[model samples]
Target: MKVIGKHLTVDMYGCSFDSLDNLEFIKTAMLEAVKEANMTLLNLSYHKFEPQGLTALALLAESHMSIHTYPELGYAAVDVFTCGDQSRPDKALAVLKSFLKPEKTKTTNIMRGDFGSQKDMKPRIKISIAPLRRVRNTSARVWSLLRKK
Candidate 1:
């Protein structure tokens, strides 16, 4: 598996907060994200057990996009996990960030698979990262590597 991920400091403005309280907005946003990511939407699972929090997950063929909200703190956590065709996650993330607007964000790159100790049977990585080619500091890379492992 080839994976490139970004944790974005999205700009979560009043719009994000408004969306959290409205079911229609959340559904629309999630559906739009699915289409933008070019992923098939299998289903959606929403949880509102906690009045102050809301969790919405969009199940996609590529992977998943999840959002957790903290209405009290006026904050939210978003995750886009795509395995094959790494561009999907970045694209989806970009849309999400643009709409949500997080203040602080960080992305980590992960190369899964290719555990080939021998000359043969090289593992195939499914991700392609041409879309997420951004300059990042070496220290950030090290931190992400350590955390991912």
Candidate 2:
């Protein structure tokens, strides 16, 4: 099996509350990160919650980047996943750190795709679906018909 991508997850702590809660700032920061990381940005979306907090997502050609903020806790969770050898997810993380300025961070790096040889692979789980049942009220019926094979 071949390695295909890198996924970086960062738990940023003690970040600036204002920066995390600011939707516009997060938008700009995400864009800057994408540009600096050399990831191709296909689309960007964000939502600001009532009261506080925000969530932003960037759909990229390589993969995607997302950030969820907790202003009350002065924390933010960020994820950057990119496929291919040329994408630099670490650079994107650095860009976000510079803008958010977290006092402490816990970062994790994961190499995605199958990393073991074929012989070492575990057998996949197989699921079998039971036959559909007729009901008088089909529209409101709930189906519980899956079983492992």
Candidate 3:
């Protein structure tokens, strides 16, 4: 099958609840996971919720990864999606699981944008163009182009 990307969704149970609540720890784990997967990180954002929860997102050149932790429940939901064949989402998950030390974990691997079955079919991309007006600002023209999408 022709696949564009791989997505691994993980449900970690019986993990270290305290570590899950630490934003810095979570960030470190995520970065280490991304590196283990051989994916390039474009940016990252993480937030610690009130009472006890944390959510961290990492934007990657191949795709993205995210981890949402429920410390009170000792569970964390993690997702790793990568478009590059060299980027191993499984390896990333392994790294994360090591850090979380979950006693029980469930994971699902999904193949995204598979198109090989339709051998005779070609994807059609449609784009409509409009006459450009007198736009002096460079940024305005870029915005206008993006608005078409």
Candidate 4:
């Protein structure tokens, strides 16, 4: 099997209900998770439900990560799909699990970009991650303020 990427699908149960409903916390936690995974954050967007729950998506240079919350059930589903070895999906999952404090976590790892025929050609490249201090602050503020409305 030819593998070009790693994808992690995580199911977190028994998390803090209140935290899942907080958009600001979710965005910050997600950004922190991406940083912890050593992934490059390209962009991030999040939306809050009518009364409760939230969904956040982080676009990364490696790939993408998404966190969908079901506050009423105290559950969240997170996906961390990254190409290349530079990104650490496990580290990202650890950070998210720590923040959510889930009693039970189920994770599945999948190999992506598998080509049946081209097994010999392995393409690789190195990338530099830009500083996110300014972008992070601005995004967090916007998400937070929007949630309050």
Per-residue lDDT over 32-89 for candidate 3, one digit per residue giving the tens place of the 0 to 100 score = 9999999999999888899999999999999999999999999999999999688989
- Which 10-residue span in candidate 3 carries the lowest summed lDDT? 127-136
Model 1, backbone clash pairs (residues 3+ apart or across chains), number: 14
Compute each candidate's TM-score over C-alphas: 0.60, 0.77, 0.76, 0.76
**Maximum-lDDT candidate:** 4
* TM-score of candidate 4 relative to the true fold: 0.76
lDDT of 4 by residue, 15-132 (tens): 9889899999999899899988999999998889978999999999999999999999999999999998888999999999889999999998777878754543455465544557
CA-lDDT, candidates in order: 0.64, 0.89, 0.89, 0.90
Model 2, residue 70: C-alpha shift (Å): 0.3
Q: What is the lDDT of residue 114 in candidate 3?
A: 73
Give the poorly placed runs of model 4, Cα more than 4 Å off. 117-149
Backbone clashes in model 4: 0
Off by over 4 Å in 2: 115-149
Question: Positional deviation of 47 in candidate 1, in angstroms?
Answer: 1.5
Residue 118 CA displacement from its true place in model 4, Å: 12
